[model samples]
Target: MSKVEDAVAADAATLGAMQINAFDANQPEPLFVEPYAVTGWATFIQRAASSRSGPQARVGVIRDDSGNVIVQGSRHSLTCLLHIARDNDAAADLYGPWQESWGAPPPDMSKDRLDAFFGEMKAQHKAVMGNVPHICTFIFPKSRGGGGWLTAPMTDLEIIMTHSTARGRGYGMALLQWSNEMADGFGLPLYLDAGEDVVGLYTRVGYVRQPDELRTSKSLVPMVRAAVKV
Candidate 1:
């Protein structure tokens, strides 16, 4: 994973809502896909037209538990993003029925609905960083690694969660192990902004916590770790 093998970019496909596409021929092919994340996100938007009570459209789910959180993406293929972007009423027709599901009153649909969604996506970008296409998502029994844009140097851990009912069972560590494996394979480092409670966790797991010198908020602790084994 340390040395780079040069490969030319051969094909690019459309991934829904992602600024970047996946399956870059130049980079290594991903080993698995996050079906839960994709289904979760697509269901959230698709059902938004019918019911707002539906679960969130993010993250790969733990089959044994009820918690899931996607970090930088919801798994919409570029094809999906373009489909919604091209049609004006498509987005509203998607998220409109779920308006009451929102905590506040719905926004004006009289304006561009796609723009409204993009606005929300932009806010998400601030939290997860720009569209990080290359990510390896895994949940216990099933595991798939690879599927990301090859341009970036580091891989984002994104959001890691274990249901309250499932905590303390080493699930979190298992997830970290998966991330480390990918980093080892790519010869890159892993980067994430650790929250207060998890700062100790990152330290114990081998992530070098960055100083708060440039911290925008007192709560966030930035950390990084070399993916390759020393």
Candidate 2:
């Protein structure tokens, strides 16, 4: 069985190609333009693997015996001390210095719409998690009279993908289980944005919809899994 390991910069190229194959190539409406996708993902992985500090991001890969990456995943966590702005400038406020890494927007993707989507996501998060230790939560703090603050930090699962040929071998679930185990080690809740088609899968794994969630035109669903005691 393939086991998860830290993805090094050398794995960036394969991860990039796999990203396009898993997310863009098969989609009816491609999220990334084909011409720029590979380099874009490569650059992203390279930078993340290099700094190892930015956003505390980490990438993992499961490789076949032949040493080809068959599945990839990335995750990060926000510490309790960081403060996120809740206003329209939230994204800019939190990520302005790192904007250069954002690169150019694809021609098929609308810059304004994308920005608006992120802006709305921030808004929803702020409403439900004002000054919380993390962006994700297990309960509605406001409804519970906790004044919109989660009890602790949460781990965010940013991306997970398995190569097409590797599907149905339980690779995706293995990666997800690895993520859950990691979060459980830290006793932090797990959060992710799930595509519409995979909502059932996430649900089966203990993730529940966020309160007052924001659904994208693409049917993205926001979910949070409560932390399991180690």
Candidate 3:
């Protein structure tokens, strides 16, 4: 039997390796930097697991009968910033002292490219959602300390991936259903930006894709699942 359990900081390295193995092929863009991929993932997982004051961030891993993690997923509420903003010059140089502070690897893309990418993403998010309760897939911390997007309260299924060797099973859907339960409890709509290949899966769980005109890129489609009380 398989069971879903909360992922702790010690699971970071394992989850990082799993992440690299799972998303390495056919990713729209490089999801993690080369040498720093594991480090970056470890940092993110550690922060999410340890930080108590920020939006509620939870990670769940599905373990096989032998206790091997076959799937990992995360959910976070977008109620407020994880940490307060501080002075920063990192925006000008993304991979400098600020990078150390963030303790995570920056995206594989260049600073200019990342800026343009995030800029368009933010624009689309603002235009489509417009101050409504929503969740986001990505957030960057400020240079001086911890920080995150301050948004209207909503639940987000941030990352959900099954191990490459375990893909044919229903682990992914199980994780999605787990997140749906939490979103239902919050009584706010759940939102995410889905990759083209997986949009159908999300749709099956009540995620309605946004208009094509709202897309910032051809590969990503934003979707929302309305809150439903159980």
Each prediction's TM-score versus the true structure? 0.40, 0.64, 0.66
lDDT of 1 by residue, 1-230 (tens): 11111111111111121211222222353222333234334533444244333222222222222221212333211111111111223223322332332222223222244345323422322333232322211111111122221111124344343322233446556556555655566554555554455556666666776554544444344565655743
What CA root-mean-square deviation does each model show from the true structure?
Answer: 16.6, 9.7, 9.6
lDDT of each: 0.33, 0.48, 0.49
Lowest summed lDDT across 10 adjacent residues in model 1 is found at 76-85
Per-residue lDDT tens digits for candidate 2, residues 32-127, read 554454555456556545643323344556666665554444321111111212233332333332224446776777667557645554454444
Worst 10 residues of 3 by lDDT: 78-87
- Which residue segments of model 2 deviate by more than 4 Å? 26-30, 43-54, 70-101, 106-131, 134-154, 212-218
Q: Give the TM-score of candidate 1.
A: 0.40
Q: By descending TM-score, how would the candidates be arranged?
A: 3, 2, 1
Whose lDDT is higher: candidate 2's or candidate 3's?
Answer: 3
Could you tell me the lDDT of residue 176 within candidate 3? Answer: 64
In terms of lDDT, the poorest run of 10 residues in model 2 is 75-84
Number of backbone clashes in candidate 2? 0
Off by over 4 Å in 3: 26-31, 50-54, 70-109, 116-122, 136-154
